[model samples]
Target chain A: MKKMLLFVVLSMTIFMAACGSNDAEGSSEATETEDGKQIVTFWHAMGGASQEALDKIVASYNESQDEVEVRAEFQGTYDEALTKFHSVAGTDSAPTMIQVFEIGTMSMVNSGHIEPIQKFIDEDGYDMGHLEENIVNYYKIDDQFYSMPFNSSTPVMFYNKDAFEEAGLDPENPPQTFEEVEAASKAIVESNPEMKGFALQAYGWLFEQLLANQGALLLNEDNGRSGVATEIGFTEEQGKSIFEWVERMNTDGTFANYGTNGDNMLAGFLAEDVSMFLQSSANSRDLIDNAPFEVGVAFLPHPENVEREGVVIGGASLWMSEGKEEAEQKAAWDFMKYLQSPEIQAQWHTDTGYFAINPAAYEEELAVEMHEENPQLKVTVEQLQATNPSYATQGAVMDMIPEERKIIETALESVFNGGDVDTTYQTAIEQLNAAIETANKARGE
Target chain B: MTNMTAVITQEDQALFVRTKRKQRYKQFIKGILFLLPSIALFSVFLFYPLLRTIYLSFFLTDASGATTVFVGWDNFVTLFQSTIFQQSIKSTFLFVLYTVPLTIVISLFLAIIANEKLKGIGFFRTIFSSTMGISVAAASVFWLYLFHPTIGFLNIIMDTFGLEKVGWLTDPSWALIAVAVTTIWMNIGFTFLILLGGLQSIDKYLYESADVDGAGYFYKLRRITIPMLSPTLFFVVTVTIINAFQTFGQVDILTQGGPQNATNLMVYSIYREAFTNYQFGSASAQAIILFIIILLMTIIQFKLGERKVHYQ
Candidate 1:
């Protein structure tokens, strides 16, 4: 009886602990209210040192305004933030501002959950010339802006200098073309049998980049817009080249298939065992700080057969929720304009190694003066400017992109696991088109 | 007659005092009513959400949050049509099929060895049960690093001995088996303890009687030990099957149901549908299917227990 009683007590304690509220714990004290001050909640998903820089900027913004207060909250990862936002947006109380990813912008805009930023710009009479040309264009739906562009980044090649020198290759001159990259990878493996030659995000993000460089359209008819209902053609002739390369790497033991986590490539690169890895430009700050050996940045490799095309932007943007009161809407506008300010944009770029969408900030006298000392800040801009603009290579706006990505990742997995690359790619195209159709129908697009 | 009446009155007075003491004990318990607030909290926080989920399985949500059209059987119909959903259900059942029997047989074997009256018996018990302390997420992460094809420790050992590295998590054929191996390593300890306890609880007199009847070790184990341990074995089998069906944490952490959906169990697919794709309606229907499976399994267990289990 005593043992049973003890067991019951222990089980109850465990259950209560699981049920206990260890919630947000209220970190900030209530600010002293003054006349005309409105507190605006802003939920974002940035963390680590990047979050610290954001917090400092928010503090400065609050100090600058006696009429508005912006309180930035750190929500969990990107997916969690979206889930939380949906849950809270229906209530009487919801955040006035949110940091949504670029992929989510089209869905949110179509859902009518957010207001058009073009309306805010016209109402407030903000100077259009103050923003960058490409930056302002990034938030367009039918050529009308809906969100304020914030953090912008593109993919680039990051390589280990030590590994290059060890393989009898020039560290200063990284691979500039696809053929050179393949050759370098083979050389690196032979030089060091213990090390892997190449690694990439298991998802088809890398494959998309390869297709873009080849100047091929992945999906037809403007990639699933109402005017153009083109089926997926990534399994066609040009796409076969990429799959063939994947197979060659897998069978030759040069390419290591990391499970479908982005961290796999980052971990392998940081360990200095992989000679070359492809990742986002936003990792520049982290790589500079944490890499044991010297790291170099270069433009994404292009094929020798054709000219390179523009790669789509992969970072996030800010969206303002609809159904907010006039006061809250005005507060959201103020915060949006504040983020797009030249000074803040430049600071954001320098702090996090993400690209500043305001191209003027890159060449303005003060910015130019600052850049003369640090030339590495110019790589993303150079990479972006040297490409031809085409819709097939432009940013994709497909509904159910997440599901599409799952199909691509599965295809890549099959290719890396010694399956027939042609069959896998064909199967992926068929699967993804079906998903796109389903999502488009559900969304009433 | 007067003396007898006086004695009866005294005895009645004593009985009245004992009854009064019992009433005081009841009042003492009532005085501890401050704990009602906590009980109310648990009922609201934990039990309420569970009941709400079961209730919510009947509804549906569209892409936009504003529209919640409750089509009772539509979601289930769509879910049943999905090839991926069907595959996940099949995979989950296969996981249970592979894990439960293997776990029971291995644990029972280990328990029998540990239950032997020998030197260092306590050490063996502690060593066998230590794996219960590792969380599923932590163990999956460790296994991921261990099985990484190129830079992993396992591959390094394989290279040393001139063996080709196996694609443990990447190959579709091997991914589910890899996950099962990690789960088996982590959970076998807890099942071992239950079986060991059951083994110890058997009355020694039966074994002594069997020995006097000239029974060998295997015969004693079969006739004397197996029947007596049937109840505990039944409980372990039911719990193991339920746990194997709900194997989400490892799949989420280690594989994410990739390599062409080889490791995609129903729970992980449900999570992807709900959280990743925001298809809450379909996800809820998948969850309902999982609930029905578990309910049927439980009923089957109970029915089987009534027939096969012997009390003595």
Candidate 2:
């Protein structure tokens, strides 16, 4: 009986400890610190090389100002950071600001969790005109700015110039169409049967980019800009083309099946196991620096018949939480404006391969020198500028996009591993529609 | 005189009944006092959340987990209809089948070997039980590197042996097995340690009597070691089954329920639905079902397994 009593007391302590209020311990960290400076907590999801560059930038911002000290925290990946944000929103532990991916725009708005940046812009009389138009277009909904565009990128084809030459193809001009890419893949395989021709990382973002390149919308309601999206807007022809392209590559044994792992696809590229892949332009710096062979960056490919309409903007934007103190908001606002300055944007553009939202940063000495040294980075910017502003190219905005991406990712994987393209594509669409409806019902729509 | 005597006896009976009732009430209050803290803790952490989960199952929740609308049994109906959830259920059972038996058999084998009275046997015991010290996240990360599609140790070995490279994490056919292998390796340490402890606690005289009867080593092991170890084996099996059913870390780190949702275990599915999809209603429904299944499994195990367990 005594042992049982002791056990009960011990377990009670453990349970109470587990259920203790977390905000009390967590909230005290980011509110303020020594020296009477309001600390603006900024939660971001930039990992790896980008985290290093971002930390340097945040540190410089702190040194530049005396009143507001900006604290930047790396909060895992985009999905993980968003989940954490939702759990902590409306709590004392919530950050003063957060960097959310482009797809999270609608969800963030509907969540009623964020203070739109437009109010801050208008109050400060800030200039939104100087920012990149295509990047801004994705974030601007209902003629209002929900988030300040920070780091932006687009899909670009990465090819091995050495392999292209080995295949007796033009090293300077990479393949510009699916048919041409298939032919090139065959040539590269003929040159050396061991090296695979292409690797598409069963990723959904690249699929969206390809769909937009063919001028197809991914969601209804004009890519969910007019109102809530109801279903997939892409026609069978538009969606099936991508699946068929992957299937053809699979049949030819030229597609390296990396299956939704970007890291492996990248390693395959660096190891010269696969010749070409489509990834975010944000990877350009890492690829150029690490690859043993010369890396060629090209515009995203469309089908043989459709005109190339360009790619959607990828990457995250700065969103201020709704209920932060006025002082913290001002501090975060200052940092946001500081980030868009030519000098900082130039540094960010060179350090990471993301676009400088301030197009004037292109003329900054740092950016100019980097662009001259590696013109592949300039191709990324050119693709963004070349993009025709349309519902398709502006990208889809839906809370369900993250879920939808998984559905499409699974379909892509099935095709990569010899699943029939037509049936797989059909099932994917049905699943996507069902998921959207479920999301809508959850929202009480 | 007679009336006075009768009244006094009735009064004594009344006093006796009143005292008995008062004593019983005081004891009940004392018992409740002793149990108060435990009751409060259980209600706060376990019971409240369980009730809330059941309540939330009958409604639709938004991103903030507020119930936006009452959906009745729609969430559960949809879950049963979802092929993804169906696959998740099948994969979870398959995962259990793969990991639990293998973990027990391998750990039992290692325990018996390490139980030998030999030189430097402590080193072998430590090595066999080393994985208990490693957290699931760390172990999964380590195995993720080993099973990486590119720059993986396993693939490197395959390449060296002049064999075809396998997509250990990427292929649907291999991903569940890969995760199971990691789980088995991580679980071996605890199971082996417990079984080893049980083996050591067995009476030396049992083996001595067997030896006097000219019993062989294997015979002594079968009769003495296994039967004596049955109670510990039962406990180990129960815990391992529960742990296997609740596996989330390995699948999250290694696969994220990809390669056609092949590794989407039940807990991971609940997580994806609630946290990822922000459908707390559906997630809660899944959770309630999981709770029922585990409850039934444990009860069934106790009923049947306890009969065979030889507790000494």
Candidate 3:
């Protein structure tokens, strides 16, 4: 009898241990509101200062009204957040709103699980005229917004003004063209033997931007708007030119290849190992804060012969999940609307280096003052405005963009390793097209 | 009277049999109850996920992990045909080859040195075992700093020696070696601790006998120590091979299987395929393939290696 009792106790202990983990699942589910206010959950990928900005925005929105309480949770990095969203999708426990990166836009659209922001806008008769066209164009498919643009950024040239001055190059006049950059880099390398003249992350985003600036589409069928991109549109000439430039710069001992890691390139710039680099304007604030010397910002350089059209946007946007309760959806939309307000956006832009999606945000007194004090922030806005809105500049909208970017990065690595540029680019395009085809077929598009 | 006595003894025998049966049943129940927790945990965590992975390998899934279409063996066929997958397999083998033996030899050497009764032996043992506490992510980040081409301490030493600065993590030729070095460094602590324990447990009389026989240090190390240490070495080799086959964190953090997929090990590829590309089916198929390969290798290791391991 005693042995049986001990057995039961052991079994009970095991069961209890198993049940312990389920406790965490309790807080994960959307809680029933005790008060009259609707509680809306938000899952975001922002971290550090960006997360702080998000919390501040949420706090302000909560304080402004008692109808809704926004509970913002940091899910992790963009990839991790998307993974979490996908894991919880189609389940009752999914958050009311989720932030997805630019690359995930098409995937979210195709999943048919999103409550398109256009529906809320149409029902509420909200005006989107204040939103920047270039930024809005990215999220719009079939001339309708699927997700609300939250944090947007465009790529530009970042240079060390102190390094430039020390290299006997004009700090105010940063390189605007590839030939000019090459010449200046040569001068910098010669004048300051310790400094590398130029460096760029071996990343596909910069390559895509460079293609966009050349008035070229990265994919076919009007960057996959008219129809799914059946093939990559980066022609051999365009691809080779970009590859050969990197090769030549490397050979000239003027350009440092940071090997596909963005952090390494950022570190090189901060340490003054490189005089200039091409990085996202969103990192402008970080660069400014970390660099010991004065940093110079300029528009990304184009080829000497190619006209500089503009760069595409990089960053994430806010998306609403489907099958959520009406009140939660309404609360989410209200929170999104609050986020898009001029004052809030201006504050976000000043706090984080992300560009304000609403053009009117620049008119905010704080934004204007902040830009005056740090004119480097203004360069990104000018660069965005300078872009001629077109199918090419709108960037690719393929579902396999992340994989495509990785392929291009690998191809770039091969070229840097002295592989033939033409063959490498061709092979990369072929592989990318195969991947896109697979994705399209899987989606039954 | 004797017949009546016999009848009583038979009844007693039957009663004794019944009581023993009841006790055996109770013990059986208790044993099962004790094992139920582990069984349940294993089924939920290990067996179910493994079976699910195999099942999912046959279907192409979308970004949300919902099945879109049945791809059959297409994922496997495609993976087998792809050059990148082929390169990843090659790289994984290269990594195992570079790390496993070197880890064993170096750790064994450290263990032998540490086994000696010397001054500050405890301090040396602590210093050797300290790396075991570091998480892979932390260690990889530290290695990244040390490998930074321009301002890294390694480069500082290279500059002092008038040697050219090598892009340890950037250059494709060196990236794999750099990651292997990091893995070896991180693994040495655990391997050293195991081997140290093994060395301490070795009979002192064997060495004393060898000393009386006029066996030199190297001769005794070869004849006495190695044969005695085979069991520990076998365990270390098996664990190291399995661990090396499953390497992901260092490759992910330090090299990201890049500079031309030089460090693209199997696990990292699986992660990239599933998480980055959202190709769950392909990732699963790749995972199953990795599982089979690791299983076969481990089986071969046990079959061939166990015979050589001396059991005193």
Worst 10 residues of 3 chain A by lDDT: A23-32
After superposing the true interface residues, what Cα RMSD does each candidate give? 5.7, 2.8, 2.1
Root-mean-square deviation (CA) per prediction: 8.5, 3.6, 4.4
Score residue A353 of candidate 2 by CA lDDT: 87
Who is ahead in TM-score, 1 or 2? 2
Worst 10 residues of 2 chain B by lDDT: B26-35
Please write out the lDDT profile of model 2 over residues B1-312, one tens digit for every residue: 999999998999899999999999878866986888878968888999999999999999888799999989998998999888899999999999999999999999999999999999999999999999999999998998899776789999999999989999888999899999999999999999999999999999999999999999899888889999999999999999999999999999888888889998999999998887888999999999999988999999999999999988
lDDT (CA) per prediction = 0.76, 0.91, 0.89
lDDT of 2 at A377: 88
Residue A9 of model 3 has an lDDT of 78
Given the true complex, what DockQ would model 3 score?
0.53
Name model 1 segments beyond 4 Å from true. A1-39, A47-73, A92-94, A224-230, A233-235, A324-329, A363-377, B1-61, B65-83, B109-135, B192-221, B288-292, B295-306
Q: What is the DockQ of candidate 1?
A: 0.28
Most accurate candidate by DockQ:
3
**What lDDT is reached at residue A389 by model 3?**
92
CAPRI grade, predicted model 1:
acceptable
**What are the DockQ scores of the candidates, in order?**
0.28, 0.48, 0.53
Is 1 or 3 the stronger prediction by lDDT?
Answer: 3
